[model samples]
Target: MLVYDVATRTVAAANKAAMRLYGYSREEFAGLPITELRPPEDRAPFLEDFDVLVSRDGPASGTRGVRRHIRKDGTRFSVEPTYHMMRYAGRRGCFVVVIDVTEKEHSRELLSRQADVDSLTSLPNRKRFNERLEQAIDDARRNNTGVALVFMDVDHFKDVNDSLGHGVGDRLLQEIASRLSSCVGPSDTVARYGGDEFVMVVLENGANSDSVAGGACQCDRQSEVIAHVMRVFAAPIAIDDTEFHVETSIGVACFPADGDDAETLLRRADLAMFRAKSNGRNGLQRFTPALGKQADERLSLSRRMRVALSNGEFRLEYQPQVDLQTHRVTGVEALLRWHDAEHGSVSPATFIPIAEENGLIAPIGEWVVQQACFQAQAWQESLPGLRMSVNLSPRQLARGDIVCVIQRALARAQLAPQLLEVEITEGALLNAGSAELLEALRAMNVDIAIDDFGTGYSSLSRLRRFRAERLKLDMSFVRGIGVHREDEVIARAILSLGHALGFSVVAEGVETDLQLAFLRRHGCDVVQGYRFARPMPAVDAYTFIHRFNAGSLVPS
Candidate 1:
């Protein structure tokens, strides 16, 4: 502790602890000015505060607070300073005591920095970003300014990590952080929103705000933000003597128009970012009302999908797969359909993705397996060699319990595993652990068929890794096959490839005689489309089977 005389502005005395801490002896502190103990930047503020406190509170009243003080070695540390007006040496002076609070202050600062900054890139983290967004919104509200939230994500960042290494990825993120900071103004806040995601909150005057009705940034300055980000990342980055080009998808949402709050703006911006990537990478998108409508519907669908099974909204229709050589029905693929009384018939393309995302696919897939197996036994008895093929969601095979589900269904229905072919999309096979799961299914004697082949950018070598028994060609390649040379070439190539792999090929969307003749000429084993038959109810299917077996079936 050190005692100083306020009237003479001199240190009166010092204790042993003060001498050791300040690297000064009691005699050395005998005539030192209080300003000498504080750093230059803090000296003026401390003196002003002390003068104000003494003048307002009178003589014996004390003032206490924390401040930085320089030691004799010129190193600065924080201290809890207190000044009491007291009588000393027969004159009015201040009794000053400063308690070292450096350690406590350092610990608090460390925790605060750790919470706000990303450990890898040293950029602001999501928590700090949220707080900054709230403050920005508050400022915008007061000043009639609008805030712009920009969401950014590195395109194919996973491929970069896989090809190079995590070390390179980390360096790339650091470089990205530097570039992001360079692109923004001092008033703007940049944050690491997620693993490969970065966000920016820009404060701008509403004089040039976006037009909410158009869902666009009509203001040139607002649109310039996207252009600036593109220009910053246009060049290739050199990492470890290697040059690599990276592209980013950016999305923008303006405040007081896109949303009134932070979370809504963030969500809208995220949706716009998805739209940017969907339109092709290395681009930008602004939040539109259509995106919000779709997002709302998706949320509703995701929530409702959980109870759709119990409500009996889900049903199956079977499309016949006719053997081209024999002109006989070899199998039928089970197609899922959903119809709600209030929302009406929802398209499979729309709701299937919702089901897969919400995890409703697993239970729904199990239900389909059981239903198909139960229907397959009776139909097999009627047609003698009919196979049951059910389409499985990509998530269905990801779950480890799939094989057990297949076993239980087959056992309960007494259906032969050979007659049950599980159809999976190439997208599902791209997921990790799917190959092992499919192999496990095959080990149990169930057949595996690749569904919607030629759609996903799947490698032929990777395709060979999975022991698939059949390839159901996607409908896109089959459409206008005889009309368009491009479709004809693609369809022919897929058919030839399937045969070369010793896998049976099925031509889908065969709606006309020309398509049927085209597949027949190509020696395609199966033809599945409208010309054969639309997916019919079980009772109608039984009736159709009776007619087909009797050699009197005609296209309806």
Candidate 2:
């Protein structure tokens, strides 16, 4: 407890609690004015507030509440000090009651920080980051300060977790957080946005009032800040007593330039980050309106894909697979076509990756398998030896119960495993690894082929390890044959390797007589491309085979 002589600006009396709260003896407290307890920065504010409290001629009841006070040791503490209008020692003054809420305030602050922090990194989480970003944007708008939101993702993070244990991965993440913290200003915020991604909100204009007045200054300065922040990963990160080199791809979104709202800015920044990854990692990309437009297009395509698949707008077109020696149709490749209600024909390259990312491929893949199996079985009854091959994406290989699905489809269509072939890319086999799924498919006697080979890493290794029944050279390599000198040698080597490994070789994208003749000369077992025939409807395929058999249509 304490008493203040407002007119004289001196302490009237001090109690034990007041003395302890101020970290001073009663004699020392009595010698100093109550305002002395406030730090220099708060002293003037306290005096102004005290003058307002005294203008009423005495302390108002209940109107007085918590006021900040500084200790003799130059530490600040909050105190709920109430004053009463009373005549103390026959002088016009006020009676004061001081109760320290410093501990309570400290506890509340700790809880607030804990709520906004990530448990793993002890740094602010996305929730807190969002709050700060909104406030920063508001401030930037008002003062014309430069603000940048940087979205960054670690490169090869999956490999880190796969090659090293997750424990080491976690440690690496922590180390990255530390390095990121060291790269920002005191007022800036760096938050772990999810998994290996991080969001950094930087305020570049603090005292530069001119920068605030000029709306363009904020963006210009922010661009430079973003460039520096992105280069933070040029150095290697040492983790677990071993040095490992890694890079970060960053995307920058600026206020009043890219977007006005936090959500839009973050989304644009994320999309730009993906663009950075696509253009080869270890660089920073600024958000462009064109990238946003592409993102919108992708979203539109994805939504339409769901409708296309559900509305039965998809169909299988078969391209005849010819034998090199006999020139007879041995199989037909089942290619997917989409007649989108809104966008017309959507290419597989456009929707396939989107479907895979959104988990829509499993169902789409199953539908393809079932439909192709049914069609192949129908054709087999006529041709008696025609096989149908359908392509499977990596997502389908990773998630689908391929063995069970194929068995059920075969039983439903009454088609044998030998009559249907499943084509998967080298990427799929690399991810599929030496799993039980591959072995189970083999046990069922399903002929598996690696499609679009030589395009992805581990093609030769995967072909050998999976014992692929067939290998289809990608159109890129096949198109290069006879034009590029090296392509011919590589093509010949691939064919020899396939034959030596007891697998049949198929050349794809054969669009000319020269390519076809060259492929046949190289002992290629089969060829399928536009040169033979574009993928056609089931009825057209049957009619074409009939015409060829009748000698009306000659084999090119």
lDDT of 2 by residue, 1-556 (tens): 7788877788878888777777888778774876787777877888898787777843475545666888889888888877676788888777877788889988988898888998778779999999999999999899876578899999889888898889989988888888787666667788998899999887767533333223335435556455455566667788758786768888988787889989998999999999999899978898999998999999998888888778888888888888888878788899988878788888888888889877788888889899999998887767887888988777777774777888989999999988888887777765735346777788888888888877777655556778878989888888897799888888888888889988999899899999998899989998988887889998999887767555688756
lDDT accuracy of residue 138 in candidate 2? 92
lDDT of 1 by residue, 1-556 (tens): 7777776677888899899889888878999988889999988987887677656556665546778999989999999877778777887677777889999999999999999999988989999999999999998899887898999999989877887888899899999988888766666788999899999987675333332212234344456656667777888889989887879998999998999999999999999999899798878899999999998989987777766788877888888888877777878888888887657889988988778878888888999999999999977766876889998887787787888999999999999999999998878877778889898888888899998898886788878998799998888888868778988898899999999988999888889888888888997898888997889877877777667657799764
**Model 1 pairs in collision:** none
Any runs in candidate 1 off by more than 4 Å, and if so which?
A: 6-9, 40-63, 82-97, 206-218
Clash count, candidate 2: 2
- The residue-level lDDT of candidate 1 at 279 comes to 91
Best of the candidates, lDDT: 1
- State each candidate's clash count: 0, 2
